[model samples]
Target: MSKAPFLLGAAFVAIVTGLSSIFIVDERDQVLVLQFGQVKQEVTEPGLGFKLPFIQDVVSYEDRILGLQTQPLEVTLSDNRRLIVDAFARWRIDNLIDFREAVGAGGVDAAQARLGSVVSAAIREILGSVPLNAVTSDDRTALMNRIRDIAGREAASLGVEVIDLRLTRTDLPDQNLAATFARMRAERQREAADEIARGNEAASRVRAAADRSVVEVTSDAKRQAEVIRGEADAKRNAIYADAFGKDPEFFAFTRSLTAYERALKSGNSSIVMSPDSEFFDYLRDAQGPQQQ
Candidate 1:
């Protein structure tokens, strides 16, 4: 029984040592073997890996791309404008050995901190040299490329590859937003007033043109009417002259009768004259007057 217990204890120890000697490297992971806190080997490939039992330990880092979001930063533009900018980055560990050497025991967390600093510096440097309009324009793509290049160069020492860095949001500070909006509104109002004034001017021109057309038409009608009236008067005078030539006594009689009707029309009218006046000659004799 004593021998049996010793054999069982030895078997248990061997099984534990066997299990501890092997480690697994996943496809998504890069591993470093550390012995007594010193890097002994790097296991970059997936599958079974061997390490000294109990004395060695494996540390792993992500092999795939990673994302990071930076806090909003206030940047001063070349034109002395201030804006709040928020950015994000896509990056990956390009060299595991250099990354381990740079970060030491701090690992991914330390690397991220250093990389974020580089990005911030790059943002400030590039943005400070440009005006606010350029930052907000479509030309920002070139500016962003410049920032990425600067940051990428600096981050190379930290063993991180910056694939891309982009500004996710850019806005005026809270204190400036209301003022900017008010100014824009004022500008729009001014433009509207100008348009309204131009419209009024055009309307006045249209009204003046219509008035001139009406005056021209009325004057033409009046002129034509005057011409027609003159023609009618001429015709009436011709008719009277022809009648007088045909019968002088009859024509004089008809004219005297028309004059008597006007002088005696039904109204409160009176005329004082001598009874034997020439104006009453027709009334005294229906034959008008003795022929001259």
Candidate 2:
């Protein structure tokens, strides 16, 4: 029984020593072994790793792409427009040795702080050179490309690569937006008024043209009717003149008889007859009582 207790104690010690020396590194991680506050080895491959029993320390970092989202920043354009710009960037550690040397295992937070400075500087420099319209228009793509190039170059010294840079949103301050909307509304109203004035002018021109056409048509019709009536009157006068020229005495005699018949048809009339009267002569010739 005394030997059994001694053997169990020895077995427990062996198991503890083995467990303390063995370390596991996952596929998604990079392990750094430190001995006495100095870097001993950097194990990046996924496998079972061994270390000094209780003398070494292990620190692991992610081996995947890192995401950095910055707080919204207020930037001003050359044209004096103020806007809040929200942005994000994708980055990855390209040289683990350089990253470890520079940042000292702070990992994402250290990388983010360094990257944020570069991003902010590049954004300010580019945005200061452009007007507000260019920043908000389709030209924004070109601006973002320029920003990416500059940011990547800046981050290269930190052993990092900027995979992508994006501006998530660009917006005006609330106070400025209300003022801009008011100005836009006023400009639209002025344009509408100008269009209405032009329409009224065109309508007036059409109405005046119609009135002139009516006058011209009526005058032409009246002139044509007058010409036709004048022609008919002239033809009747010509016929009468030609007939009178052929027989003047017969025409005179018929006219005198017509006058006598018209005078006698008045039933209340009384006539004093004279021998030399033309009326008496016409009556005597008709009756065949005297030859004159």
lDDT (Cα atoms) of all candidates against the true structure: 0.91, 0.84
- Return the top candidate by lDDT: 1
Give one digit per residue, the lDDT tens place, for model 2 in 1-292: 3799889999999999999988989999888888986888889999989889899988887788888877788888899988888678888888776777778768668878988989878887788788888888865778887888899999988878889888887898888999988988999999999999999999999999999999999999999999999998899889877887898766667677788788778578787777777666666676433534
Root-mean-square deviation of every model: 3.2, 7.2
lDDT of 2 at 52: 92
Query: Which digits, one per residue and each the tens of the lDDT, describe model 1 over residues 154-273?
Result: 999888899999998889999999998999999999999999999999999999999999999999999999999999999999999998989987787788789988888989988899
Off by over 4 Å in 2: 1-11, 201-292
